[model samples]
Target chain A: MTTTTAAPPGGRAARAAAPSARATGPSTSGRRRLAPWGFLAPAIVLFVLFLALPIGYALYLSFRTEKVSGLGLGSGSRTEVWAGLSNYAAALGDPEFLASVGRVALYGVIVVPTMLGLALLFALLLDSRRARARTFSRTSIFLPYAVPAVISSLLWGFLYLPGVSPFYDLFERFGWDVPSLFDGDLVMFAVANIAVWGGTGFNMIVIYTALKSVPSELYEAAELDGASQVAVALRIKIPIVTPSIIMTAVFSMIATLQVFAEPTTLRPLSNAISTTWTPLMKVYRDAFTRGDLYSAAATSVIIALATFVLSFGFLRLVQSRAFASEK
Target chain B: MRLTTGTRIAALAAATALLASACSGGGDDAGSDDGGSAAGPVELTFWTWTPNMEKVVDLWNSEHPDITVTVNKQDGGDPAITKLLTAIKAGSGAPDIMQAEYQKIPQLVSSDALADLAGSLGDDVAGQFTDGVWDAVTLGSDAVYAVPQDSGPMQFYYRADIFEKLGIDVPTTWDEYADAARKVHEADPKAYLGTFSANDAGWFSGITQQAGASWYGIDGDAWSVDIDSEATTKVAEYWGGLVEEGVIDNKPMYTPEWNAGLNDGTQVGWLSAIWAPGVLAGNAADTAGKWEMAPMPQWDADAPATGAWGGSATAVTSQSEHPEQAAEFITWLNTDPEAVQALVDETGIYPADVPASTEALTDPPEFFSNQPDFYEVAAQTAQTVQPFTYGPNINVAYSAYNDEFAKATKAKTADAFVDAVDAMQQITLDDLKNQGFNVSE
Candidate 1:
């Protein structure tokens, strides 16, 4: 009796409501399958137009060069021609480009490690129960993230000026000699400080959020096993947050390589920074100041490739140790 | 699954209608004909990097009632140029007028981004500006792309009280200047005469300009590099000697030490341009009436008294929808006596127009204690400027030379600096050659 009742229209309705109906049944396939595509259509269109189109255009432009016939006096005389690998060769061979890369690499070495280390330390301290004024310190340390990079650079630029600086005044009061932070030897560090100060808090919050995600039960278990808070942090907390740390490090590396805003903003005050101070700066100079967009495009592609390689290379090198247990 | 084919077709039609309208609205706003005379007032967008440009825009707006001019203040020289170039490439959204530096004119002209003003304004407009100003804006034999706005005539500004205390008079020659710097330093071990930033090649460029040297020369279809000329060497050597002598404060500009020096009288003087007086006054406001301007110490007694450091020109873009109105606005802003005077009163920018200068000579600024007529600066600018062509590869040459200068100054060897500059000149020539410039061997 039950079989007969279920086998009627009720069974047909249940079959229609089943998850595999659209995939397996021919009756429902055409009408049901287009919904996902419709949902994704807008986003796919936007992504292609805004992101993919410009990138493809830049790639095309990177392989082109201008040819000027005769005196290049008029519009018809100058024409765009395929350059192949010449622009890339020129960018790679450029001493200025190499110097900028070296300078930025050194800058990243100083900034990334120091900034992330401080951020992690601050985050860990904030997480500690015995730490005093956790709320105040966290807010104050994170306050700089609220300031824009340009504004931060401007503030630091003024502070580096001896006349307006309290540090300079204090040095004078003590009758001690003072050196300029904008000097050739120290300008990189001065720029790095601005980047670190502006970036540390945001990274700290990211790390802290990762730490907060760790269950208190794990800590309880560690404490029960006679492990101290410091030991638990060293053995468990840091290991658990390794993914977040890796993410921040990757981002910081990219930011360091594209160090244009801080140096550009600081330029008006100090004469130490040239037009081609960074790779991105050099790209800007070629594209605009020098009016050689082909070379600029070539250089940009090279830098982007370098960033991708470095990020992945570093990730791969650390991934085994960082996410081994998680996997 | 059981729906009729007609219903599906109707749904598709409705979706197409919605998508078409959305796409059309987006395209319409982005691609509207800028030249069309709409019911509303015509708006012109002007781009400038200078903070003082706001004042200039205000002056222009007050005088022109029919057209509204919108000013977009951008930062960083290179970024502004990038934005301008991108807008031009996009074939729309470009500003009607832009403030371009004199050195940048060559690159802009080469790229065909600027509108040739000479054809519209005629030879009389070119004649109205001083020769140096005119030459800086002209590319090859083509019409001028930019209208001369102001000249950055280099001068030496010193703290009068500090100089008096140290018993140092303004020097006439480089030698005398060095001697005075030494005396000032000896009198007050804590004081240095001026600051030089290693990256700022403007000082070296100004010195070269004063020495009657050109960075590039047109030789048939090719451009010749003259950055390693004897005049350039002389200027580099003189500056190198000053740096080595430890008389000039080696403090990098915009650094904390330099600002401190300005405030507390640690820096005695600085060799700057006409626009510098305003900068110095703003930065060292507490030291008002304490500073005074003097002729820049020449390399030799026979050297010219003036040279440009940095200045900009106003140019109407080729993409401007209202070229006639744009040209009119540029002419009035440049040549009108009242507009020029208002600009000077508002921003301390000396007018490039001779007639405007003549009118401005009547009113002296009280800020400088009425020491000299402010318009006298315009007169000096007119007297000392010499014609110098700005070739297409000028920016590249300038950057190479600046880096070379820094190395030489740091090395404390004039000869080494000259060698470096010559090497850089070669590199610049090579780069330009690759960029399609006809570089002279």
Candidate 2:
């Protein structure tokens, strides 16, 4: 469930290290190694306690299940039984799990591209000199990031309702018929819109910052060669920010894979989303709602592994291309 | 790179150490050898999601100054269960007492997270509640895991004004209900008899129970699951036909759209549990005095039956240091007249007591047109509700039903409902068998 939250904190440390790695290239590495390790002891202790322990325990639980002997009426009757690979086999073969995977894959296809494209567009707009109300627009686009996913889904859920929605009221006035947003086909877009709204801003900020880091002389050099502002942005600005864009895409994909809060919060308003709407929600249903911790643990491990492969695969693809030119 | 790798390895080793410590420290600190009667003031923690429960807790605290209880409000539904499970698995942070829904009792019992109160409480304790309510908390004949706090017997609430306008009397049988639904829809294109919420799996479960569908039954030591029985299929076909015919709007409940439908008379009635009156009263105050309650429409004209829906009980966790005191509090809170009355007065939760608290039956809120007749009808319905057992896999079964119901509603087909129920029954049966329980169709 917290697959999204787990990535961000770890991502923050990497983000913090990116520029500094270049700044302190070969200097002061060996001299302060022990001192830095001593200083990092508390963080290491906390990281171990909070993150690694829970993960290790989930892995251990994924391989074992509770078996009921007689009646299953008392504590003595139920015993933990080791069932190697069975839970994973069950999760993999389950049609519901496969359906959830398909739904999330479709969701990712819609959300990631739309969100990144809009973020790139907005970042370029903000970096341009002639843009109007840049501060207001930037803040407005990024504002949703401050609102939690649950709250934004709730806010959008109301706006999507026919009776309470101003948009529905407007549509009626215009004599235009519109289907309810909570209907089966349209509900996915409604959910995807919420994710895109909440995400584009943060990714925009990351890309915008990366665009700012590119030397002004590069743009000046391009402009001197009879280049337009769009040409400079499309060629010079975008390529320089490829690493940041790739990082954002990886993070967005990870978040999209674990879409729980939006669909869950929207459920009270829409019937389109089931309790097992996403893989993470399914894992949660198994663990707490069904009290099948072993199945839940196995599902989570599967999700975590999927995320690892997707993120690393993208990073490796981008690294080979980007670094080949650098070398 | 070297520094980063070193820190990462150090973090990994530290995490391993933390996990090892957690494993070794799994034993319960509150040993039963400490004796039941602990001296001095015992501070007990209680968690519940029911709003306005403060008055009940306050009354209990005032009465038992020696055993002060702290009330903490947790979120309802799956999230609350998640918190409880995490606390239990962590071997700490569990509240002594918590509110558990009736359907969740079997699951919690299987987890070994609850203490058996049958041995500690007197024999008369189980007899205080109605049969349906008592069976919800009791494992068999002897083992009681929780105290029945409130109940929701299925009831039909209709818009009296709308029925009069449509020139129709209240429906006594489901056939008449369907005819009225069609007439109401034909009379006003904007209105329907009721909205069918496909997402509301629990409500459908209750209706099926009313139709004499026993989804879960304990036969000796094994569990019998029949989710797609004749009765259940009948219910599914009836509702699925209603959806397909446009006699009912397939809208999700508890949303703004549903509320607007009620307030504006687009939806004429709600077929739900006794809790419907309170919810409708709170959400659509403009429709006050225009609504009336009746016993749920029967599947057969000669049969007088109902089903149970949402109700909760106070259960003692296994981690509690003072089980006897906790049981005493739970029993007193549920059975004692003052505490039960306080709960009704504060939260509008109808008591599950057999005799029916006088205060609950007598007091008529103005929101229901100042009529207390519904209370008596509700109490009678509560008594007539079919007693059934919820399996440990009930939640999973519920979600599976919800998934299938949603598909059936969307596809507008009776066959879809049958297929959904078939898949649900098969999934749960396999799951139980895999879990080492003797499950049979």
Candidate 3:
């Protein structure tokens, strides 16, 4: 992997300056600077320790490996040595790793658009004047987000089994032989359904909050222009919530690339999902199970780089378009 | 050449700086914890994955007031390894005694994470356990790393009622076993002789062991990896045909569906280790009296052999402050009759203690219809297990098997053996070579 261009120091300075600099009572640069620095110190320190240090260490470890001599029976036979980019090359060349990447790409294609579309629909319904039981529907929809991914996956894993699934009994009663949810062809959609169920509610809340932030005057002017609620929603509400939608999309894309827990938890229920079914799971298998930390570190670095490039490139494209439209 | 040297030097410098900073943060915390409490008792932290481990630790704690041992339960296998590795990398927070599976000992030993216990554990202590279990924890003739705790000797578990109904004798050879699979499935399309769990690599390894396929063996100074040997290929092709003809179910074991199948008589036979009886009895409570045990089928019925599966040992980490005391506890825990009994009562598996006499073995649990004596059968079976050491990165090989098994099972010809050889054996050889081991193919 190539070195990521270092984020600029001036960008931090600009961020530090842009937040409520003019609104502060102290017009003097020194007092205003002191307050922001004090507020930012804890976050900066945390960012360094939890994020930057680990990334740097992984980068360092990715390029180094242990060289063992003789039988490798003991510690004395092994010595840490520099391996350069061999681990990265191996990870890239590996068919299993490439297949996992391809699988996750397909999963993301199925999950993201479907999840965001449902989320947008829910948020619009909650905001609409004709909607009933707003609180009930909102709470019930968002309830799944409260369950941890492992627990949710395990719950769905059982429901996918024919022996235990109510759907199986229901289908059998109707003289319909329902295909197993864990069949190889349907397993991806089954996995994607769990993600969408757990994810859409949270995204809906984000878009709903953004919808609430829209000025009432815009809606009033749209009604004065004799526009229907659907027309107003399509033309005004969605366009205004574009930023939140883009943010959710980017976050989901990053998350989808690093999907590990759902498939791992669902593995015991199905034979179709392999140990290296996802790129992140392969990294996990390499590091812990295989005891090949160097390859794991390199693969993680590759995943991190991919996430950054995809998320940043997406944000940049969306931001430029959003800004252009506003102007 | 100059640029390469410069890069190496730079990388080394960066690594040193990283290590130095980490050391500075954690260097003082180690000696500080032991300072104030030295006069009272030497506290040792132990980690294990077995459920209801508190009883065993509590037994030890009550016996020895001088060294109070604290118990920490971790999820077994990969998670525990990850936690231990993290602790080692950070230079602290490792338990004094932790349980490492036999398959993982080589990997842990290569990392230098385990303490050499040869000095503390003499030949007398080492001689008590079974030879196969002993070799798993030892390096060459000396350098004992862990004490053997338990073993899983492969056994044949089948439904006697079903076999009687089919008028087929219990197959003692692979060829007869294949014939039995065909006859049983042909008789009832709803049932198969047994399942071939695509996800269970350990079971496959055990089968390979039973078939006398030594995938990894130490040859003088190098590790030999021959995963696609004639013996292994024979076993794979045998299973592949059964799977290809739809005589054997290709389902993952230990799932609810598998349990349902076993209980409902859709699965007539199971070939697994001694540890399976407990799980089978629990899952198939309705079919309690129907199951029975026999020696695992062999390549030659005249000379019987079996494979070894899921077993673990108590290993002392290199990070421990009191290695001698830790070794003492581990030895006592495995060798002492009372401790062995307690472990057996808690875990419901036979411990690999000297004399091999425990109530668990002597008294057959009522779950298996009281007809087949579990202890007598397993003890005899354990004796027949061919001693094999799972080489370093064995889990990687197992993961490869699980990853490629579906395709391999689909391929009807000898191509299945080729896939198994590539994924299970070749990948591991390449990985071990990359890790700088001398691998002979």
Candidate 4:
């Protein structure tokens, strides 16, 4: 009931870089840049409309909250009020949000490394001269990536259930005592598996494309040096694809933080996952289900900020090594 | 003022909800300012999730060409309410009328998304619904928000074949129910009598209601939350005990695994609402005729009690340009003898209109054909639905139930269940207080 903050310290969201920068060129003035500007107009308009405008509106909403008088039943009983940093503070202070962050961090730890490692391995195998039926293997591995997270979660959810799972039946037939995927701590792993299964192939394609871009002369030189295939891959292929790996890792990290659909879809099958199992889910619960857009906005901003810092900070930290390795 | 994490979030949410709704309400007034040109038959958009609802609406369209109603089927439950509220906030895209669950009525009313239909609906409409059903729409206030469509009085459904195979009788009391659960699980380790569905807050609320728990109370402008009351704790502990004892499954209901269990005979019974037959028939068609309906196991054998689960009513949105016509459509849709018969015959809902419903239901649902008097038992079950109050922040409370009970069931301890109740009470109370309500601690 107390208005915690007065000045509204941080609602602006930097507002520094306009979404569509003016087409800067050799001349600051004339119609020479007009053709290029016109060509880029569609992309600029889309970025402004879809991305920038929503971000600005969310920023504005995050600074505000409602003031309800009495029962909040009738019109005019509730009025929009300025709520400065309180929503942000509350979001950061919330244990559920913190727990979700922790869950996603753990999920990222499991998903990113395993996905990248497998992707790198597959990319190397596909890049090798001895690789056979490459198209079929590549397509088969990448097939799961085509499945949306919701559908994949549902597919994996059925496979995890004890009542209907063929795996559970198989385990029972073998008389092997396997812990349920939904049991206490295993639910996290169960969800991570879906993300990995759906993500590895895409990352593999990215690294493989980079591997294709690698000069064959380097492979011929390594072969002339009497290097084994494993030696050549580990020494040459992996190093050359490191930049692509770094880019994929950063994308995976951002995707990890923004995870919403998989755990949500799996929720019906497992009792272990809460409504706020991830930060994005909490934001969704707050905004839509609870009808409180302010908190949702603030929480999303926090997530966006976290994503920005983690991704950019990561790029900054690894830029020298990754780019140097590319040379 | 440093507050608890949940309370702080609740406070912020409460504030935004009020502000958003107030803004939308003003916009609603402005958007429709282009004169109510009363020329042609008023076209009303209705959002609902009942299957074959278009058929019933088609029936209305034929009879009353003046008022054309379009049925926009939604995903129903929480998602529909969320979508409606979002539309309300965005100041457009909302339908003329929406199907709202009883628990969600409070949240919708609190958001000012629903219009007051007391003046628009017919005078006799109030008499059509039972007091418990009516209390939900009105919130015990004079302002009528929605007309009752269907009622879901809780019932106990069991697989008779499984019961006979296990040599267990239908449980008549809570103690007997517990005993039967133990025996069933003992007979086959893979099977269970039922499950404690953490995902379904409505089912949990119904259980609490049967134990005589009223979660929220309103007096004047002040609100009181009692989610951790003795009645609720007792019910929670009972289920927790059974689950921890490995008699009842700790997993949720309405899940694929549960559906498979029903088909495979691992799931022996269901503590569900009257509309369960339709769901059972849809989920496990092979198990039909093997299932039978009974009154929920009693706390006291002499004094039976029950609670509503999935019933929903149609309400006119505040954004609607024609409240009168919308109200008229809903009233006829629920109360008219022909429309009520069509709803029962096509929609598979247990109609809330007391008089019209009794007349329409002559035979048992196909899933419960073995029980000659399905509606008879359902009608009797409907009478025992205890009166309970729902507050505007039931969403927060329900979300709290999902969060807290998920942890409790995972822990699989009766003590954890009690702890979960306390957590729900704390979170709900904090949310109410934080939302700037006059909540008494």
Docking level of model 3: acceptable
Where in model 3 is the C-alpha error above 4 Å? A1-36, A212-237, A319-321, B1-41, B57-63, B165-168, B358-360, B409-414
Tens digit of per-residue lDDT, candidate 4, span B1-441: 011122223234444444454465455464354336776778888999999999999999999988999999999777889888877775876889899999988878887899999889777889988999999999999999999999999999999988988889999888999999999888888888899988899999998899899999987888889988899999999998988888999888888888899998899999999999988999999998999999999998899999878799999998888888889999999899999999999999999999999999989998888999888999999999999888889999888999999999889999999999999999888877766767765
Docking class of 2: acceptable
lDDT of 4 at A40: 97
Task: Write the residue-wise lDDT of candidate 1 on A1-327 in tens digits.
Answer: 988987878878887778675477775676477878889989999766545555555676778888765444434556889999998998999888999999999999999999999999999989987889887998999999888888898888878876677788899899988887765658899999998898889899999999999999999999899998899889999989999999899888878877888998986566567677898888877765666777877787788778778878999999999889878
Best by TM-score: 4
The TM-score values for the models, in the order shown, are 0.84, 0.89, 0.87, 0.91
> Top DockQ: which candidate number?
1
Residue lDDT tens for model 2, A146-170: 8888889989999999988999999
Q: Per-residue lDDT of B312-415 in model 3, one digit per residue for the tens?
A: 89999988888888898898788877888888788775687756445435677677755656677777888898877678777777888887775565454446
Residue A196 lDDT, candidate 2, scale 0-100: 91
* Chain B TM-score (model 1 vs. true structure): 0.86
User: Looking at candidate 3, what is the lDDT of residue B56?
Assistant: 84
User: Per-residue lDDT for B1-441 in model 2, tens only?
Assistant: 001121222233334333433643654654334344566678888899888887789988988888888899998956777677666656666788989999888878876778989887878887788777888898555788899988888988899988998799999999999999999999988788888787787898899889988788888888888888898888888888888888888888888888998999998999988778779888898999999888999988677899878988999998888888899999888888888888888888888766547554675656775566767777677778886778887877888877777777778777877787888888778777777787655
Candidate 4 chain B: minimum summed lDDT over ten consecutive residues — where?
A: B1-10
Worst 10 residues of 3 chain B by lDDT: B1-10
lDDT of each: 0.74, 0.81, 0.80, 0.86
Listed models, DockQ each: 0.27, 0.25, 0.24, 0.23
Q: Backbone collision count in every prediction?
A: 11, 0, 0, 1
